[model samples]
Target chain A: MFASRPVVHPMEVAAAPANPAQQQQPQGVLMKDLPGMPGTPSGLALRVTQFLLAAVSLAVMSSTSDFASVTAFCYLIAAAILQCVWSLSVAIVDIYALLVKRCLRNRRLVAFFAIGDLIACGVIFSGACAAAGITVLIAQDLLMCSENHCSSFQTAVSMAFMCSFSLAPSFVLNFWSTAFAYRVVAAG
Target chain B: MFASRPVVHPMEVAAAPANPAQQQQPQGVLMKDLPGMPGTPSGLALRVTQFLLAAVSLAVMSSTSDFASVTAFCYLIAAAILQCVWSLSVAIVDIYALLVKRCLRNRRLVAFFAIGDLIACGVIFSGACAAAGITVLIAQDLLMCSENHCSSFQTAVSMAFMCSFSLAPSFVLNFWSTAFAYRVVAAG
Candidate 1:
């Protein structure tokens, strides 16, 4: 059942060589080792994606107030969806490295990192939910204004629910990552 | 002039045990001899603080639409003050240890956590500025409405700034923790 599993160290899986000398060299001559920077390519990509998402979110907020502006709303939704995808990708990669690769050899490091990942995932998830909720609330507000039959309290409740729901995903991610990290670290 | 400095390998410093048992009772002890749970004190305290802060933020958001009423708005000032205290304490205790004691003792972990701290500080600073701007905008709106000169652009700007600012601190905190945890895993 586990015939294809790789016996990789957790640290090795997480640590990508950042020093140019340690990178793939031309035609097999041993390159001199140098101090490497931290963070993997995936991590770097995620950071860039996060920054882009933040920028798009800011731009959307600045450009529109009416939720009915489909273009602006779509932009916001796109940025959020992108964030979710990035987060899930990271989570999946981490899990894969831990499981199939048996890469979680260093228990301490894994535990710490897992906790951190969980928290980040939770926050991002929550933010997404909140964004969606806000959109719905705005739509409801517009509808209420036109109809003059809806209670403000209902809108407030919806907003609260939305914000809380959005926060939940990130929190769950954080918890899961932390638990996994702890197990790895303790095992090591 | 440099009498106080002790020469030690960075790896040794980075991997130093948090528990005295790991250091002092190694011959008689197994890995489990050390406390099963690490950083329990700090972890518990942090969780409590986070809960309280979250509660305050929720209350503030629920009470008023005025940005000033948001607990996170106040936290900008609080975080600035806390940053000073934390930074000074870190310096006094050995910056490396302070940064990575509870997380893990690795250069990558320390660096990541430091970055996280910096991000959190930056978010708080920016949020405070945005909140101040919001207060000003609110005042302007009140004056304009009384004089029948209110503009939607001003409202849009205020909302944009507030939303942007609101997201920063938590976002930074999330990423910071995640990155730090990942480093811990890598280094472990």
Candidate 2:
């Protein structure tokens, strides 16, 4: 009885054309077509913005003579540097993809982007929160916010927050795109 | 000329049995069969461990007489509380799945787990880092580490770190499983 039916490999099944519904709609579009997705113009813009914000954050914090004296501020500097490097590299990739008009929706590439963004999110979040914690202490007069470059520190921390905020959508979209690409090959 | 071939649906193509290579391999297994994956015994064990660690972290931190005195410590407390609640709830779900011998590989469930885990990771990581920053300052004698349950606070921070570490594998597994389950539905 089974032999009467055509043998269908699962891999081929992923691209099968029998279902009219499947044929009518595009497949594997979990927000991949969004403007901010990787390889798109908006993606490049977002990456550039992230890079600029992180760079400005690091630069602003470093300008303060006494930032190094606090462990939280130092951590923020490290996080900002990481964010800057990551965003710049990805922006370069985005620009290249745009120039060539190539799709950056490959599973491996999406996975890489997702993981990198996740790490960046965690690191920057911690740095920003820690800096904010210390800033609160300073504000409460527990320490000397007035004797040092407190305003600059605050500005740098806010920049980090902005950079992280921009990263949030990218992170979710890439993760969703990756999930949509999961057409696993069948086993014998 | 185009009508010569059979019309196949993409959904069926995902499960097609024609490809010998695909038939020889298991489909949709991005580490989903591992013990630590959801709906498995090891997954339950990991969740229990996470819950215990987070609970202990919160308990220890709150035990200190002056933890509320510092904003960083207060943040740590909040993070620990969030972790405890999240892990405990998931552990209950894991247990129920195990009791019924049911698979928890549904797309929505996996997505929920992934997002929750990501948020927990960020929160706890920031909390731990902030607490550690304060600890460093105290150790350097910039603050009074010798007074008001300093050692207890340190222990609590360590517990939070451990809880986050335990969550790392679960986070990766759930994300992978969610990706593997991403078979887009055919449109009507």
Candidate 3:
């Protein structure tokens, strides 16, 4: 009976096996029987959805502000650039893990990714807090001293700091979720 | 032989069994033997660390802002209030979940809590993004229109929105983790 079934390797198992019993098998078994696809459709769909939501959210946020000012535009450009770098770095790290099959270990890589991601989140969060703080301070100054008395240079510096602070949490959370997803994928 | 062994209920199990053989038992078996107790000391430490880190991160971010006017103080206060609310809400929800043993069965309450948590994460994310966006806009306006002409009112609004947006994912993650921990406690 065992011989007739053939000695199939674990990796061939399909992600969504035809039989639920088969689906419960280990990853190696699934990988062996299943085709070696570069990426799973479900994973791709999830990534696309996350990207779309992020884009929409960012767009909505940007729409609320006047982008025509050079200072504002420069800040926006810098933020955009930073975001790109942060996201790409995460993706690259994930890909590297996947390629190496280190993802299978459920090991320290998850923690490493988590730490890196959190640092990024911390940066973003810090930026936001600083911006909000500065905004409040500037508004307070204006209310107290009149618009002419408010220091523009000081205010600008404050805004930059606030924006950076606010974004810090985001990077942390992103790292956390990515690590979580990686664990799930590896387990599956 | 089975009957000879003491019929300890699942809820009586505290932490992992000392026996290596029993430690490897299925989660269901482990849960049946141990009722909930204070989680491992390490887990508690981790939670405390996370809270402190988050607080420090927020503080650092606030310090960076220029706060030229009294209005800036208003924004800062608002941001602080929101953060406090968000954090407290999470703690409250966690406590409630623990007390009620909501982690056991799949129920409407769990779903409701999950949704609420997701919304919170969204709020956090949105706030952060908006703060960054507003900073850029303010900088631009300052450079183009002069110090007196530039205002970050719109950016402030955006920060509020972004703050709301960022809270969702974290909420979901926390809820699930707590639920899992509950199961672990119940099973042991």
Candidate 4:
């Protein structure tokens, strides 16, 4: 298990690569080399799913009458729109990378994806919770919603929740890839 | 910038250590070796702050009359309680590490901390948004809350937000360190 290789200087190990961000082309150094990560087929699929769910949520909320009157619903609408735009943009990137057969393993790009996904995750989660909370209050406690309005509000909230769920895996995968990239920089 | 190191075996590098979990005591490495990471003094301070803020939020929410009647407020209470318990436990661990001058740079432990912090961040954020939304509705849209209840709810939401803010740095630091650890294992 201890096959020796030619000696390399510690300073060499410490030195940064000329283009570190674009340098990782792991031949056989480790496990599958960032498999199923962002910029891959799986990532493209995730992004597409996110975009569709967010769009559906946004459409549902937009169709609801006077949804703008409730602050929570308004926030949900805004978040859904943000999610839709962000996911669609990333999906387009993923498609281009797939068409060109280029790996999206650049540390910088993955870091950007990770941070962006995190922000989206937080914002969407907050929106869904807020909308759901208000819907609950309106339907159960306040008794303020007509049957039709109440159903529309509930549908929009549920759609928002579905959007959040679809975004979760993307968030986790991006985070892991980014974390691994940072680790590679330090260890190398 | 290319320095060489003594020859080491590819197999040995690939081989897992007998106690990999306890073996990371980086010395003479770049970037100060996980400075301000979890289990350090800075980490301890973060945990303490999170605990105090969560506890205060919980206390305020508990003191409010009819808070349980609102699902959103109940969620906030639950999240705050969870935050307090989680943060306090981690703080105790941090204290032990500090007193003994032991670094908590174990990759596994740090990974655990990162995941836990992420969960707590999401939960707290959602709870804060939900509570804030309902509070706004009650006070402004519905005009159902008495002056005293409205003020108390507002205070609790603000504290919960503060708790989330304090947790953010801790989450980021732990994530970075854990990412580095994973990289080391892969790139060795």
Candidate 5:
């Protein structure tokens, strides 16, 4: 009974359209997209921004010793450290590539980059999010004590938000470059 | 002074050795690698596990309404919804690909999957981290209240940790498939 309905391959379905113009689009995109290239100006800029964001996230969250009191806040600090290390390592490589006018051609290195970025991305998100939750409570009148504590909470939340903004671009850039690099390797 | 160093193009570097064996390995990997293919059995299982983890995370955290008072607990519920929605959507598509015995061959769709998975990963991590902070506060005697509250806090922290565990595999699987898909498209 199930065989009554014709099953088709996605490639066949796409090929059936027989539109030459349509077939050309993906290659065009593959050639034009720069987000996946490792040492392009924009890519380097993204790495730099990521490093700065991690620094900002760590710095702002740690502005008050009170953060040591909350486990989530502590988690954020640790995540920031991971993010910073990864970003710095990539940035150094990117600079080397630029100065030497050569690409990072190692497939293993690219794979490692992809894995590390993904993990750091996850770590930073968790840290910022946990801290955000705490800050939200403090913002919404959860803190019944000193105005000093309230101000500190407000400052920390802003830092978390900043961290989130930084992470978004870094994630996009990393995913794009990793895909692009793999595609290049596959095609070669 | 910079001109003292020789500059060479990346393509030229790759072309220089002209190793026939090296040329063949990428395509072999392209054909054999399952990580980059969607709708495979392992891919589907990863999604299902993610959905279940999110469910467990929410259910355990919400065993008592007391969590509602804490903003991080509320955030965890919201993050779980995001995780579930993304997981279910991908699973449905994966099922279709399996039933038809065809790949999800669209480049745009694969890109969308990568972006969505990354975002959800970030969201869930954040929620788990936030709730983690609060639970630690309670466990460390920072709460200064009822013993029942302390017990509930312990339970929720354990659940968040489980959520973290589940998220790791899903992220890895998503990254692998997305990279593979892009490589296929680029090669084509």
Candidate 6:
């Protein structure tokens, strides 16, 4: 489809006019647009989901360290760890924001979230695709799925994708808000 | 830092108020934000870069077809091909846009661009990381660097990253514009 008319969907709900925060709330809006804003329940939940997914992915893949048998496995570890740490830190920020009732939404903060989430999304996507590729090898060409830690590899790959998917909404949300902040600038 | 003030950067140049596209330009802005906005020098350049990079990545990786030894290699093919097709069609669109001077920007189109660019970026990232992981394995653990297609593998991985990098600016530009367009939605 070349050009479809605009429709108000779930994603656009954040930009709805009745959102009073929009008035004196650029910062708050940015914070709320975050997947894991500390003050917002929805955002925190998204962050938790990402953390849990990354952790699960790591646990499943690491269930058998045979990942070291391939560099992709090592990358899975790196991606999972990065997701974990990122989710954890954001979660902490959420808590801190909640405690202070402070808004974390601002152009710079949204930009930070956008960049961080995007990079992690990239890593997770790469890990998942690579692991999936290798998993296919173990199952088909290698015919080692039955004997080796193939199941673990599969599980890990699945979780890596799950982690990526989980992080996606936040990425989208942060970027959407950031775009708004970005458009308001006047250049020389 | 949770709350940093915004800093005007190069990316914001396109969105500056002085740009004629700002007024009666929401649709045009959306159109211009596209990577393949026909006739436009910058837009065409971005599309060409993406196409060339993807093609090069595929050519280098497919040189030996030893990649078939690993599923990750297969995935790389898939990613490369998708990129190739996507870029080609968009390139055609750029040509069309140039000829017609027609507006292709709209919420749905921008949304499509956001989702498509984001997904492709994810796939490219995944492909590169996976291949790189395997490349490391071949060079170090397998001690096959001197004998096998190590150089080829390295070249492919580099090209894949190069493709990814080339795609980044367009992706960022599209999202930035999408966010701007997105902000105009009616509030609740």
Question: Clash totals for all models, in order?
Answer: 22, 31, 110, 7, 4, 13
List the candidate 6 regions with Cα displacement exceeding 4 Å. Answer: A1-38, A185-188, B1-39, B100-103, B185-188
lDDT of 6 by residue, B100-162 (tens): 886556666756765687678768777887777677777875788776798888888888888
The 10-residue segment with the lowest total lDDT in model 5 chain B:
B1-10
| TM-score versus the correct structure, for each prediction | 0.28, 0.78, 0.36, 0.81, 0.68, 0.77
> How far in Å is the alpha carbon of B149 misplaced in model 3?
13
Candidate 5 lDDT tens digits, B24-65: 554423333354346777878777887787777677767776
Candidate 6: DockQ? 0.28
Report per-candidate DockQ.
Answer: 0.03, 0.34, 0.14, 0.44, 0.24, 0.28
CAPRI-style grade of the A/B interface in model 4: acceptable
**Model 1, A30-144: lDDT tens per residue?**
2111111012334334444444544444444434444333232343344445444544555565556535543332434434544544444334333433333333333442343
> How much does each candidate deviate from the true structure in C-alpha RMSD?
15.5, 6.1, 12.8, 6.6, 11.5, 9.3
Q: On a 0 to 1 TM-score scale, where does candidate 2 land against the true structure?
A: 0.78
Better of 1 and 4 by DockQ: 4
Tens digit of per-residue lDDT, candidate 4, span A1-188: 33353333334545655445334555222223444466688888888888888888888888987887778888899999999989999999989988998767676777688789888877888888888889888788778786548887778778777878777777766677676655555445
Question: Which portions of model 5 miss their true places by more than 4 Å?
Answer: A1-38, A100-102, A164-176, A179-188, B1-38, B89-106, B141-154, B164-175
Q: Which stretches of candidate 4 lie over 4 Å from their true place?
A: A1-36, A143-148, B1-33, B143-148
Deviation from native of the Cα of residue A88 in model 3, angstroms = 3.6
- Pick by DockQ: which candidate is best? 4
- TM-score, candidate 5, is 0.68
